[model samples]
Target chain A: MLQAAFVLVGTIFFAAVVLAVFRIVRGPSILDRMIATDMLVATLICALAAEMVQHEHTRTLPVLLVLAMTAFLATVGVARYVTQQDRPGGPQAEGGAAEGSAEGGAAGDDAAAHDTTSGRAAR
Target chain B: MSAAELLDAGSVLFLFAAALLSLAAGIGIVRFPDPLSRMHAATKPQILGLVCALVALGLQAENGATVAALVPILAFQMLTAPVSAHMVGRAGYRTRHLRRDLLLRDELADAIDKAHADAAHHDVEPDLPGLVTDEDTSTPRP
Candidate 1:
């Protein structure tokens, strides 16, 4: 009876994980998607560990550890990368490029003009 | 089996609770708007969920060695989950893209500024030997 309960609960958890994978794939932003993927990986690890317990398979513990470690490291690495992109003069340092675009040139000029006026006001 | 055969019922209940918590965590991670909020959801729920599940496994484990083996994994997870979340949060702040309205003070933002100011005061060149030999250096190489 206990084993059956575990099996049922584990199966439900696995279904939720599948839905998380879809969110990961369809997230609007890269960070959103990466976070979803990280959650999916974590869910998968827990599910595997639970399966091992349900089956009384001690050998599977090592495999679960390896997978969890890999997923954790990968998630951290990607999060770091995305965070770096958010920095000033980071990969998204396209403020200058936006200025060069004809459609944005007027706004850029206005910003520059505002800066000069502010500087003069400060003086 | 008699009522005496239900000795491991608590383990089954805990396992069920853990599974439900994990599912809630998955929903939280997907639904939270920002990284910081999501990090809160991810770490806290996962830690609780894992603890519950591992405790249930430990209760059902037949031998001392198997239960003992479970201890280290739980300990390591408890220690590392918050550290990983901290790193992700710091990285987000350093990048300056996080939604400031969501944050209260932005302590990390101040820290990054102080670091940059200290580096500037020291006139530390990026090419200086031993300054950035490590692989994780954020400064671009010539």
Candidate 2:
């Protein structure tokens, strides 16, 4: 019964890997790709953990730590890079565009984008 | 069922749930319409799935050493996942990948505007303590 459950979970993990890969490849924006990549590492960790349960494997635990750390650093590094982007006017222009959408009366969804850009203000 | 069988059953159940949650998170990343929403999918369920799977492994751990090790692993995951996701969210917002239409309440508009304005006169962090003010502060800005 335990083995069977492992197999079932393994199948699910396999499907998750395929789907996450698709998201990474098809993700439209750089940030979309980043989000997909984050999901992929998470799926990998889940799959590995499931395998550890099935095989009675207790030796390879450090690999999980290594994977988590790598994912964390990579994500933070990229995020810092994106936030401090060198483009002088890009963030401002986008901010303006978001505001314009708010005032121009596309109020429903546009407000979300506007408010998030300046989290402090909305508070 | 014997105690051993019951233990295995518990581990199996946890692992199964973990796998399904992981799959759902993956599907969320693929299907969510925007970056922020995709972030919602990416971090929360994924962390829960990781914890579930790790807990299952801990349940089956044969040695005290193994369970001991598992303790710190779970702790680290709980600590790190959100920080990474938050950093990503910040990057996405600054980069403007966030879809305005899907957003519910963006608290940062004024901060970004302040930062935008501040960029001209001096180098200031958009979220510098004084930069962001309450709603009343939104008015009277030159």
Candidate 3:
């Protein structure tokens, strides 16, 4: 009876992980995607720990920790990359441009100017 | 009921509840539209669910070695999950990509921008406190 109950709960947790994966794939923004990934990692850790209890296996706990730590690092890395890209003169500078010519380059410069101006005003 | 039977019943019930709560937390993260809300779903549920599951495991564990191993895993997770969430949220705020309508007010956003501006004026690379830095931005990248 106990084993059956665990299997049922484990299946539900697995389904939730699948739902989170769908969101990660479909998230409109990079931030949303990172958030989904972080949630997915946590769910995976719980599932592994549950399995260890059901099977009476002690080895799986360390494996779960390693996986969680790796996922945490990956989420932080992606968040850092996204923040860096959004900075002025960063990789997404072109995307911030208003036109497709030297005018576009000027427009990107204007955006940077606006950012600095607003940044100053807020101070 | 016997002592062994009672322990078995409690362990099974706790494990089941923990698993369900974890699943709900995952669903909340996926369904929430913004970073802060998703974070709300992520941090609390994950920590609580893990604690309950670990407790259940502790109850079922037969020996001292198994209990010893489980305790550190629980402790480390309790400490680390929140720190990681804070880092991700700070990064999102610094990038200015987080959805604004979702926030009531953001004092951290103001602070980060001010720090960045100050660093820019001084020609210094702003380093996040306690973070390990790999590259110095003052040098030209090859």
Candidate 4:
């Protein structure tokens, strides 16, 4: 029963990873990508813990500790950068306008892109 | 079933629950409408899923030391997940990544507008703490 459970859990984790990857690819904005990446890391951590449980060992526990501790730093850095970029007369002021226009267009296109992704997922 | 067998069964159950949470989080990230809404989805696996998996790990641990080691993983995740979520959500809000129409309440916008009006009022003529009237304090400058 335990063996069967492990296989079932593995299959679920695999699906989770695939879905997270899909979100990463389909995410419209940087924040959306960041959210997907965060979820992906959480899935990875859960997978590692499941492995430790299945193997009946502690060898990978440290890896779990390190991953949990540091995963948020990337999110913090990206958020700070986004906030800074939005500020007028900030270091990236010149390029911000161009990027903002492009992002605006992407936002306009978001509904269509969302439909395609959901359609593909459903199919 | 013996004690060891029972523990193993418990661990397996917990692991199954964690896996389901991860699956849910993935679906949420894909289906949520905006960054803030997606954030609500993404945080499930980070906190609840990790807790479930750690509980499973604790149940299956061979020794006390193994269980002890699992503590920090949970602690660190609990500590950091909120901080990151706040930062990301704030950035999303500031960047206009969230759908304003979908929001039920917008206290932040009200506060921001108030602050901007105050700043503009101050920019025109700086307020003196001593000279500031009660009426001026009660109603914000237009």
Candidate 5:
């Protein structure tokens, strides 16, 4: 039963990788491509975990560490790159705080929102 | 079948279920119409998938070392994924890469426009309080 389920899960995650690759290739916008790549990283982690079951091995755990860390670094790097052109008070001056706080559907001013978050992060 | 083998089979089923959750993330990334929604696609299910898979891996591990090492990886992933998603979403919003029509509500648009308007009028305060010159700085008359 373990072997059977391992094979089945492996096949499904493989299909997921193929679809993520398709999106990375055909994505219409830069952020779209980034999102696809992030999903690809996630699927890769899942695949690795499934194979850990297949081989009945646990020594490959370090690979999972490196993958998750690098995926995060890549995402933050590309995001900063995308917004590099914005001036401090440009039309999108409030983008960072606005979008982050907007995730909670808040109606607070951007500066105030950031002030609170940064304070909390500092603590 | 042995009891240990039965236990391994159950964990493998968990691995399969996590694979399915990750499949939903991939499909949502490809099919979601905009960056914010795509970000939504990329975060929640991805984190859940990783947790589920990691849990199954832990269950299958006979050695304590591997399970101990896996804990930090899980912690780091939980910490960073949301921060990365927030950064990406903000960048997309700043660059106007979003499809406003697809968004249910945009609280940022007007706030951004207002910020710009306030900036154009030179109403923003710059936070430099330490610098002083003889021309604009007056000394106390003792």
Candidate 6:
């Protein structure tokens, strides 16, 4: 039964990792990629715990602790940098041009136009 | 079943649940339309999934020392997940990475606009403490 459980959990984790990797590679924005990275890390932590449980060991628990403690730094650092880039005075204000193609059905131009108009109204 | 077998069974169940949450997060991150939505997708596995995983580890631990060592992992995850999510969500909003049309309500934008209006009435730049400038929002560059 334990062996069966491990196989089942391993298959699920494998599928989850694949999906997260797909999002990371296909991101239209850095933030999307960052979010996917966060998910991937969480999955990693869970997988580590699953491994420890299966092997009946605690050696990897410290790795789990370190990962949980530091993973947020990447998200926070990227977010700060993105906000800085968005500022007019900040370097490379036109950073959006390099931002890969939009995901399907989003109509990037229409969204950009709507955002500017609404933003103006807000201001 | 013996007590040892019962504990093993419980640990397997908990681990299974955590893996399922990870799978859900994977699907959510890909399918969600925008950064903020994707952030929502990522947070569940970061918190609840970690909790379930750690609980499973604790159950399978051979001694109190091992279980004690698991506490800090859960604590750190709980402490940091929201901080990172908030920062990312704020950045996403400021950078026009969300689907404005899909939003039923945007309290942050309304609040920012209200602050802007108030600052404008005072005849000064819309600068509120902790609130950034409208320059970022003035142009949509997604």
Per-residue accuracy of model 6 over A1-123 as CA lDDT, tens digit each: 789989999899989999999999876567888889989999999999999989887788889999999999998998887753443212342332222223222243354434333332333
lDDT for each residue of candidate 1 in A1-123, tens digit (9 for 90 to 100): 676787798786886686577667644335555566666655665676677667766786666556545555666776656633433222344543233332332232133233223322332
Stretches of candidate 5 exceeding 4 Å from the true structure: A83-123, B113-122, B125-142
Ranking by lDDT: 6, 4, 2, 5, 3, 1
Compose the digit string of candidate 3's lDDT tens values, residues B1-142. 8987787778777777777776787778776755667777766446777777778788878888887887777777767677678777876555544445556787864776787789999999876553222233222212
Give each prediction's DockQ, rounded to 2 decimals. Answer: 0.20, 0.41, 0.28, 0.38, 0.28, 0.44
Steric clash pairs (candidate 6): none
Assign candidate 2 its CAPRI class. acceptable
Q: C-alpha displacement of B85 in model 1, angstroms?
A: 2.1
Angstrom error of the Cα, residue B25, model 1: value is 1.1
lDDT of 1 by residue, B18-136 (tens): 77776776777777656567666665335677777777677767789888877767666666566566656655544333444556685744655677678788997333221111133
List residue ranges in candidate 4 displaced over 4 A. A83-123, B124-142
Candidate 4 lDDT (Cα, whole model)? 0.76
**Candidate 6 CAPRI assessment class:** acceptable
Query: Stretches of candidate 6 above 4 Å error?
Result: A83-110, A113-123, B128-142
Candidate 3, residue A88: Cα displacement in angstroms equals 17
Best by DockQ: 6
TM-score, every prediction: 0.67, 0.74, 0.71, 0.78, 0.73, 0.83
Q: Candidate 3's fnat?
A: 0.44
Lowest summed lDDT window (length 10), candidate 6 chain B? B129-138
Give every candidate's TM-score on chain A.
0.59, 0.63, 0.64, 0.67, 0.63, 0.69
User: Where is the poorest 10-residue window by lDDT in model 1 chain A?
Assistant: A108-117
TM-score, structure 2 vs. true: 0.74
Ranking by TM-score: 6, 4, 2, 5, 3, 1
Share of native interface contacts recovered by each model: 0.26, 0.70, 0.44, 0.70, 0.62, 0.72
